[model samples]
Target: MASIFSKIIDGEIPGQLLWTDAVCGVLLDIEPLTPGHALVVPRAEIDHWLDLPGETLAHLMDVAARVGRAQQEVFAAARVGMIIQGFEVPHAHLHVFPANSASDFELSRRSSRTPEQLAQDADALRAALRTQSDGAHVPGEA
Candidate 1:
């Protein structure tokens, strides 16, 4: 069976995707520590970040940076925090979240968003990414 991340990438389930490339995909965390919390996940379901091929890891971070920048702008965060905790899901994923303080980095604070809020947040990030990306389409930009 595919990891849930893979299922999201494959459209088997809905996800608020922020970016996508041949190597990886960035999506919003359904349960977010803060608004604009995003996940940078490899298309391949590697179970551990350390086990990823070096180039793949690099690509993931590069995309994560772009997503984080959009999150920072859209959420007006003081900083964007990055974390890797593979326990919740088998697939290796990097969590990139908008942060106003150290307390915003706590995974224990994750909360679910309503569908309306998710769509609104997605639009905000898409607009920011459109400007940042020089008009390139961010994943699921609509």
Candidate 2:
């Protein structure tokens, strides 16, 4: 069975995608800890982060760092956070978000945003990513 993340990646379901590459995709979280919260997920549905090959893991981190940088710049975040909690979905993923304090790491505090808000956030991140680098991996800009 395809994981929800896989479905989103495959366009089986709607997702607020911010970046995409051969290895992984970055998308805004529906239930976000902060306004620019995003997830870095591999295309392969490895259940645990440890199970991923070293090269795949490295690629995911690289993408995550890029997204983190964009999030910080776009949100004026004090700091950026990355967490690997595979319990929510069986697929491996890194939760990257703008963090102002330790409290921002609390998963229970996630808030829901309407589709319109998510689309706006995605657009902002895409625009920021385009200006930050070559943006070869950003969907529309690439």
Candidate 3:
């Protein structure tokens, strides 16, 4: 069976996508630790981050760094946090979010966002990405 992340990447379900490239996609988390929390997931349904090819792993990190930069700018975050906790979803993914302090890293602190709020957050991050050097990876951009 396909993992939920694969379903989202394949468009079987809706995702508030911020960036999409041949290798991976970056999208806002429905359950976010902060206003701009997002996920950097590879297009392939790799079950563990450790099992991914070196090139794919590098690409995911590159994408995460891009999203983190945008998150900092858009959210005015003191720092950007990233984690590779694969317990929640079988498919490997990195959670990237804006952080002000160490406490912001707690996964238990994540909270749900309404569809409207998610859209607003997505719009803000997408706009911020447009101004970034990696802006070309953002969907619907020139």
Candidate 4:
């Protein structure tokens, strides 16, 4: 069975996508610790982060860094937090969110947002990401 993230990547389910490449995709988290939170996920369904191939893991982190940079700028965050807590979903993913302090990194702090709210957050991050990169990874980019 495909993981929920796989379903989102495959278009079987909707995802507020921000970036995509051959190896991975970035999407806004519905249950976010803060606005502009994103998940950098590999296209392959590897359940454990440590199990991913070196280059593949590197690519995911590289993408997460990009999202973190954008989050810092757009959200005016003092720091960007990242974590690999795979319990929520079986597919391995990194949670990247704007953090003003260490406490912002807590996974138990996640809060749900309506689809409209998530879309608004995605739009803000997507616009910020477009300004920093080639803009190719941003959704609806031409």
Q: What is the C-alpha RMSD of each candidate to the true structure, in Å?
A: 1.4, 1.0, 1.3, 1.1
Writing each residue's lDDT as its tens digit, candidate 3 over 1-142 gives: 9888777776789988988889998888999999999999998898899999999999999889988999999899999999998999888999999999999999889999999999889888898888887478787543
TM-score of each: 0.94, 0.96, 0.94, 0.95
Which residue ranges in model 1 land beyond 4 Å of their true spot?
A: 135-137, 140-142
> Which order, best to worst by lDDT?
2, 3, 4, 1
User: What's the C-alpha lDDT at position 74 in model 1?
Assistant: 85
* Model 1 CA lDDT for position 54: 97
lDDT of 1: 0.86
Model-by-model lDDT, in order? 0.86, 0.92, 0.89, 0.89
Clashes of 3: 0
| Residue pairs clashing, model 1 | none
1-142 in candidate 1: lDDT tens per residue? 8999988877799988777778988788889999888899999889999999999999998888888888888888999999998999999999999999999987788999987888789888878888888645375534
Per-prediction count of colliding residue pairs?
0, 0, 0, 0
Task: Write the candidate numbers in order of decreasing TM-score.
Answer: 2, 4, 3, 1
Clashes of 2: 0
> Per-residue lDDT tens digits of candidate 2, residues 25-139?
8888999999999999999999999999999999999988889999999999999999999899999999999999999999899999999999989999999998888888787
Q: What is the TM-score (0 to 1) of candidate 2?
A: 0.96
Best-performing candidate as measured by TM-score: 2
Q: Is candidate 1 or candidate 4 better by TM-score?
A: 4
